[model samples]
Target: AKGRSATIFVYGATGAGKTYTMFGQGEREHQGLIFRAIPEVFDAINAYGEADGHLEVKVSFLEIYNEVVRDLLQENGGGGACRVLEDERRGVVKVANLAEAPVRTPDEAQGYLRAGIRARTVEATAANAQSSRAHAVFTLTVEHVKTQSQGN
Candidate 1:
């Protein structure tokens, strides 16, 4: 495909170092997968050097709790329960009413991720005092905009 996206998902059991490995255990020293991966994605895109237009990077964070999708980046924590609609005309699935933020650097992406994480739902159970009840999904959308003047 001339223009498409690349996606990766991270999953694991509770207390299996999923959150710690994905976002690090707080502190800036131990940067996690999201931090390292976002920068690398930009690096690869920069290296490819689009023959035409420019590139834009945007990120979206969401959590699926009890089968309900919630936008973690929305104002006041989350934007409540959202819907996953399939765009038949576009042939793609979209999350309605989700907050997608444009980021130019990995630092900005990290900031967005941290904010979303803070907004995530955490509860205390008999087994684990601190447990995340929702399944988080972080997406990095890279857009390559080619214009007619660029002579594709």
Candidate 2:
């Protein structure tokens, strides 16, 4: 995967394994990165720094629910929120500051994820009691010093 920037998109109908697959088991011990990818990325960066070298990583989370944007991190003081903001370039949308949760290990990442899942919004719908009616985006920004460069 040299010179490749990975991008993954998980999508499916209700009751599918989209979330479960991404986040692993919902159990506290087995919780995956589905809801905590940003924190996980930070944890990875920290781990890499400790083992290999230093690097900087930033994360952000956003959600669009019923045509409305909600911040999943700022709500309840990092416990979770539905705050929406306007961006001149990105337009109006909901965004979360994942930098607030700095995870240094996989366990810490899992803890944040468990808290996030508990705080996530769920409503009882006609078809499903707990239905997810929004799109959640977890972004990770990785920066490192390049030892070598390719010339055009």
Candidate 3:
């Protein structure tokens, strides 16, 4: 279980709420999973009040278009120019130049998400001009370290 990891893949048929549910369409009341999950996670973590441990949340956003990956949080186009390689020793897949952002609060996370969303591949559509043309992946890295009171 320690070595195993999980991922939440949000997908559905076209016109379904995949985009709507993931990115929150238009208004805040209709916020999507990505938006809603952030604060809730932080609140739950913070509920421990530093007694459980010190937690840090780092985030990253990426998009896969036509099998090519683009780093959403990266300012330069070079971030997209990555080579995929597998680490046989560690049995892990690696993207050479993808970017990961460190975020403390939900607002900071939201800022990264917004910037990532804006960087996504979108084009004019009959339903919405800003329709996402690629599949986007938002990742959060939660690192926890126990305090002296909790552990030696």
Q: Whose TM-score is greatest here?
A: 1
TM-score of candidate 3 to 2 decimals: 0.79
lDDT value, residue 50 of candidate 1:
62
Which model, 1 or 3, shows the larger TM-score?
1
Q: Give lDDT per model, in order.
A: 0.84, 0.55, 0.78
Q: Model 2 over residues 1-152: C-alpha lDDT tens digits?
A: 12236677888878776666666665556654454455556555655533333564444455666775555556562334444556879675544343445544545545555555555567776756776556666554565644444572
Q: How well is each residue in 1-152 modelled by candidate 1, as lDDT tens digits?
A: 27676655677777777777777877768977887798888887778766677888899999999899999999988977999999799899988988899999888988899899999999986756778878889998888877687454
Ranking by TM-score: 1, 3, 2
The root-mean-square deviation over C-alpha atoms between each candidate and the true structure, in angstroms, is 2.9, 6.7, 3.7
Report how far residue 56 has shifted in candidate 1, in Å: 0.7
Where does candidate 3 have its weakest 10-residue lDDT segment? Answer: 1-10
**Which ranges in model 3 have alpha carbons more than 4 Å from their true place?**
1-6, 49-53, 76-78, 88-90, 124-129, 146-152
Give me the displacement of residue 118 in model 1, in angstroms. Answer: 0.6
TM of each candidate vs. truth: 0.84, 0.58, 0.79
* Model 3 error, position 95 (Å): 2.0
Q: Which candidate is the best by lDDT?
A: 1
Q: How high is the lDDT of residue 117 in model 2?
A: 53
